[model samples]
Target chain A: MLTLAQAQTIMSAALAHAGTAGFKPLAIAILDSRGAQKLFAAQDGTSLKRGEIALGKAHGAVAMGLGSRALHKVALERPYFVDAATHAVGGSLVPVPGGVLIRDASGALLGAIGISGDTSDNDEAAAVAGIAAAGLVSDTGA
Target chain B: MLTLAQAQTIMSAALAHAGTAGFKPLAIAILDSRGAQKLFAAQDGTSLKRGEIALGKAHGAVAMGLGSRALHKVALERPYFVDAATHAVGGSLVPVPGGVLIRDASGALLGAIGISGDTSDNDEAAAVAGIAAAGLVSDTGA
Candidate 1:
């Protein structure tokens, strides 16, 4: 189970990584296995909407059980599916690179992390850093 | 004004208070003055619905410019108003006792906080504790 402590750890690591890498202020969202928000934070100076956008990406990743990068690829071929997915949840499911699913060492789905603020690639990098820092697996862009 | 650091401090204090009080697992939501979510978290073992419900209560408190307790009173006096409120916001408002408006020392509305997963009274207690811990005011019930 993704405990709140673990979620906070992941967020801290992600923010630390972003800071060390000199990325812009970012927001991070973590959702549990059931796609409910476990923890979320928006760094000071991030856009006002960063928190919500980060949550949408995390929710989308958890809903699909895959990284948003994969969905981005799918969006290229089937954009309508992306739109339908967003409409179904009444949220903006950003099919971008920053949403990544988390898993245990044995590959059990735990939850997901979404990062936003800098470039999508940088955001994804920070998320991966956080997942690794927490000793969890990122089942995206493997 | 509410900053991200203050929001984190509030969540930490709320969770600690809940743990000490031995309340059920909880979900907390904090929203900025603009009705944007600033922070959110769900403790381990909380039902998946907790986060959403907490968010709804917070949103409702913000929309009505009062605490959930007041809204609850209003709900009792005017059921139709509650129904309209729930419908008008696409089902985000929850007129319950777990939501509390947050204010600065100057009596400025900073945001609102919501708690769910325990009895309404317990939830309100935790929210109030957190707000006080952050040196903010909960302009409801005190």
Candidate 2:
């Protein structure tokens, strides 16, 4: 289980990295392996839809059991497949980068973190930083 | 359509009201009449699912063309009806007091606002105050 405290830590570190890196105000979401929300936050200046985008990234990762970086490649290669998956997931799947799976040192999946409000690569970097801060491994599906 | 500025004003005022009233930390969501998100924010320390609950409240109100207050009554009078409505809305409908319709002074619908993280009545109060702060009318369906 992904503890709430751990989820908060991931969010804080992710936001901190975003601030330090001069990224746009971000929205972040953490979801446990079961696709339940663990924590979510949207910075003051985030656009209206950023929150959903963030949730989608994380939810898609957990639902498909693949980090969104891999999903992105699949989306390019098989748009219809990803489209069907999105429908299967209740339309919460966002096939893109910036969604990273969280795993313990034992390589057990714990949860995922999704970030929006910057380029996909930069968002993924922040997710990586946050997971590292919690002493967890990040799988960007690369 | 609800502008981002208006939505933020509503959220800030609602949060301020909650703070002054000693309510718990809140999660707020605003959806335009078209059911598109306008804003969402969850205070630190909120429970994991509060964000989705907030969104559900607002989305349900927008989907049904009535305040969640009325939906609550419908739920009590006919549970199965509310259940069907919930499914029809993709499971976002949350029939409760905290979901309110936003309208102009002339009674034209503009959007909806929903709040979670406190008693349902208290949540409704905050949503009302937020809409008023934005110079909009609130229809609680009471």
Candidate 3:
């Protein structure tokens, strides 16, 4: 099970990395395997939209069982599927670069992290840092 | 304003209440003033459907600026309005008994909490317990 403590650790590390990297204010969301959010935070100056977008991305990651980067690739290959998925998830599917799945040492699916409010690449970098700091593996590339 | 920490505290309390009341496993969702999810949790053994339903209820609470119970009353009085709302919010409006608005000390709107998995009354009870535990007032009665 993905504990709330671990989820908080991941979000804290993500925010710290975003600040250190001088990225724009960010919103981050963490969701468990059931696609239920465990934690979420939007920086003071970030647009309110960031929170929903972050949630959409994280929900998509868990729903598809793939990192959003991978989903982005799939979206590129089958654009129509994106529309279908967005409708299927009640407009919560966001195929983007900042959603990553977390796995335990046994490769058990723990949850996912979604980041927004900066460039997708930078947001993803922060998420990766957070997952690593939490001693979890991220399924971004694989 | 409801900080992410406060949101987490509310959700934790709600789940605890559910456990104490011997309700079925549940999914709880907390939404910010902008109707964005602040935190969510699905207790183990709950169906995945609980996640979306929880979100819908929370979104409905925020959208209508009333607790789900009040919204349900409104729905009963104006069924057509409920249909319109379902279309307007991208179908996230669930005029049921598990959503409650959270407010700060100054009576400012903070957000809303939504819970699902048990009977509607039980879900609302848990939400009320959670809002109280967070030291925030709930507009559930109003």
Candidate 4:
């Protein structure tokens, strides 16, 4: 399980990156091993719904055992799976940026990170930075 | 039944734990026995869909008498039930994170925790921390 401290570091780094990049962001969230939310930050100039989107994207990553990007690939391959789960989950399940699945070096499931605001790609970059700054690894380039 | 205080503590603990560990996340939700929202946190950076997903997961946890993970698996097996529920709720049946069924010892229903951000696993972990921090029991393992 990634420690809360680590999650904070990630979020901080993400925030810093966002600020440096002059990106528009609302909130950022980090989860633990079991896909639970650990930390949440709603930055200034961020709307409330941005937080929800980050969470939803992160949720999708955790549920599917992959990042939102990977989920997007799966959605392309099998939209039905995504759609079915989407319906079951109500209005959540966005396969876009701002979400990444966290895992250990040994392939253990750690958790996920979500970001909102900016473009989908920017959100994803922030999430990546947050996780990386935390010293934990994200299952990416897979 | 988990009191509102407990629910709030659960969320706090979960957030603390997430930061300590290392994750990126979004929002979280808590539901009571009647499937009503008791506490909700729309963390920063969550996606637009997180609130709904969290609600759906929590709804599934309470309605199906299981955690959102279990509900997710079941929904995967039976997409129709998920489909039916979506229409039933005017499109509010997220079986994703931001939702987890909360239960008490002796297998009694208390409520649920729905989380967004990070991955579903991360969301689940956050919920676990929140519940544990609150000294409440979560039936995610059940």
Candidate 3 per-residue lDDT over residues A1-142, each given as its tens digit? 6876788689889989988889997889888887766667777566768787888778898888889998898899998998798898788978989999999989999989999999989989999999998999999734
Candidate 3's TM-score: 0.78
Candidate 1 at B33: error in angstroms? 0.7
Error of 1 at A46 (Å): 2.9
How many clashes show up per model?
A: 0, 0, 0, 73
- Model 2 scores a TM of 0.66
True contacts kept of each: 0.87, 0.07, 0.35, 0.24
Give the runs in model 2 whose Cα sits over 4 Å from its true position.
A1-54, A62-67, A73-91, A100-142
TM-score of each: 0.95, 0.66, 0.78, 0.53
Q: Write the per-residue lDDT of candidate 1 for residues B3-83, one digit (tens) a residue.
A: 888998888899899999999999999988877888898888888687889998899988879899988888899999999
List, residue by residue over A1-142, the lDDT tens digit for candidate 4: 7778777788899999898998985588777755678998898888758888888887777665567887777677655447745664544667876688776677676788888888988888887877778666776323
Candidate 1: misplaced stretches above 4 Å? Answer: none
- In model 3 chain B, the worst 10-residue window by lDDT is B39-48
In order of lDDT, best first, we have: 1, 2, 3, 4
The local distance difference test score of model 2 is: 0.87
Model 2 per-residue lDDT tens digits across residues B53-101: 9989999999999999999999999999999999988999999999999
lDDT of 1 by residue, A47-108 (tens): 77888778878888888777999988888889999999989977768888999999999999
Q: Which predicted model would earn the best TM-score?
A: 1
User: What is the C-alpha local distance difference test score of each model?
Assistant: 0.88, 0.87, 0.84, 0.73
